[model samples]
Target: MRLLAFGDSFVLGQGDPDRLGWIGRALAGRPEVTLYNLGVRAETSADIAARWRAEAKPRLVSHEPVRLVFSFGANDCSSDGGAPRLAAAQSLLHARAILSEAARTAPVLMVGPPPMPEPGAAARLEALNEHLKALCGRLQAPFIDVFRPLAADGLWARDAEAGDGGHPGAAGYQRMADLVAAHPAWRSFTGAPET
Candidate 1:
């Protein structure tokens, strides 16, 4: 499988010591994958939508199956002083465009944004997640909700309490990997079990 993962710093495995991030941990035992982690720090859905196609087209192999995984919205939910970086409706608009284009090119899967360890951020992100879930449903693409569960468990909160509030350590990344690896959609798409 040729996988191109696009999103924010979490997808980049920002705070992880090993630097493989969740994508690596999820595909840890699989040697057959050709992965291109195109996760950029502090990028919103708009940023990803703008750059993904240009970045992905050159790397796609004509003969092999390709997959695209998108995890964004965290930065979009962020408010510098007044409003969010990207409005919820605009975020959905970008997603619709990205997923529609991506599906025509390859299989598409979306991992909803994870919770921020800061106050009031979970609710904001949760709302974005719900909107994204509905959008993905209409597109018939698989969506994974990492925010609610991870937020409830406080794994990211704990990590933030220590340091690096935005990105979690190796364990948090592992938890994300486990979630994606165990998802039926992922298994069906990749034809591989959790590693």
Candidate 2:
């Protein structure tokens, strides 16, 4: 399987102690899957939407199943003094366009934005997660809610706070990897259980 992980700094595993980030940790031992991490720091969904096809196209190969996993919106939810960096409506519109184009060729799984250590960010992230869920429903894509569960967890919260006020440490990234591992979408994508 060929997997493409695209998004922002969190997806890149910015503060992880192991330096592997969540994506690398999640797919570490799986030799059958080839993962391309295209996570950029400080990028909004608009940026990802703009570059997804061009970035993802050449990497795709024939005779192999391709899967795309996106984790974004943290930057979008960030406030510039008072206003969000990317408006909620624009975020969804970009998502609609990106997912519409990607799903036509490969299966897509969306991992909603993780919680940041900033004040009032959790609620905003939750709202964005809900919006993503609805969008995923309409698009027939699988959505993973990483925020809801991690919002209340001590490990993720503490690690995120202790790190850089944004990215989490090794323990938190491991937890994220665990969540993705347990998800049915992971199972469906890998097909290891069936084999």
Candidate 3:
């Protein structure tokens, strides 16, 4: 199986001391699957929507099954100065277009962006998360919501607080990967038989 994980720096596993990030940790010891990490630093939803298809096309030429996992929005919600780089509405529009187009080529999974420990960050991200979840539901896509649970997690908070307030350290990334691994849809997508 070929799994392509797309997103911003979070998906790239920035700030992780061991550098596995969540994707690596989630797929740990799974030699059956091939992973392509297309995570870019400081990219917004618009940026990813603009380039993912072109980048993924060449890598999917083989006979192997292909799957796509998108986990962005942190850069979109980021404040460069006074306001966010991309408003919530704009982010949703980009995501809708991206997922709709991606689903036709391969099975797609949507992983919600994790929370940042910055002021007013929760409100902005929560709204985006809710809408993204709803969008996934309408599209019948598998969605892994890492926002709310991580927001309340002590380990997550500790790392975010100590680090850049968005990307966490090894422990926090492990926690997030655990959540993704435990999701029923993730298990199904990864071809792990149900427990």
Cα lDDT tens digits, model 2, 54-146, are 989998888898998888999998886687888889999999998988998688889888887666665676788899999999998888887
The TM-score-based order of candidates, best leading, equals 3, 1, 2
In candidate 2, the residue pairs with backbone N, CA or C atoms under 3 Å apart (3 or more residues apart, or in different chains) clash, namely: none
Tens-digit lDDT track of model 1 for 26-127: 888888888899999989999999999999999888888899999999899987656788888999999999999999999999998888854555568889
After superposition, candidate 2 runs with Cα above 4 Å error: none
Largest lDDT belongs to which candidate? 3
Candidate ordering by lDDT (highest first) = 3, 1, 2
Tens-place lDDT digits, model 3, residues 7-54: 999899999999889999999978998999999999999999999999
Worst window of 10 by summed lDDT in candidate 3: 116-125
lDDT of 3: 0.90
- Residue ranges of candidate 3 with Cα displaced over 4 Å: none
TM-score of 1: 0.95
TM-score computed on alpha carbons, candidate 2: 0.95
lDDT of 2 at 60: 87
By TM-score, the better pick of 1 and 2 is 1
lDDT (CA) for every model shown?
Answer: 0.87, 0.85, 0.90
> For all candidates, what are the clash counts?
0, 0, 0
**Deviation of model 3 at 137, angstroms:** 0.6
Alpha carbon lDDT at 111, candidate 3? 93
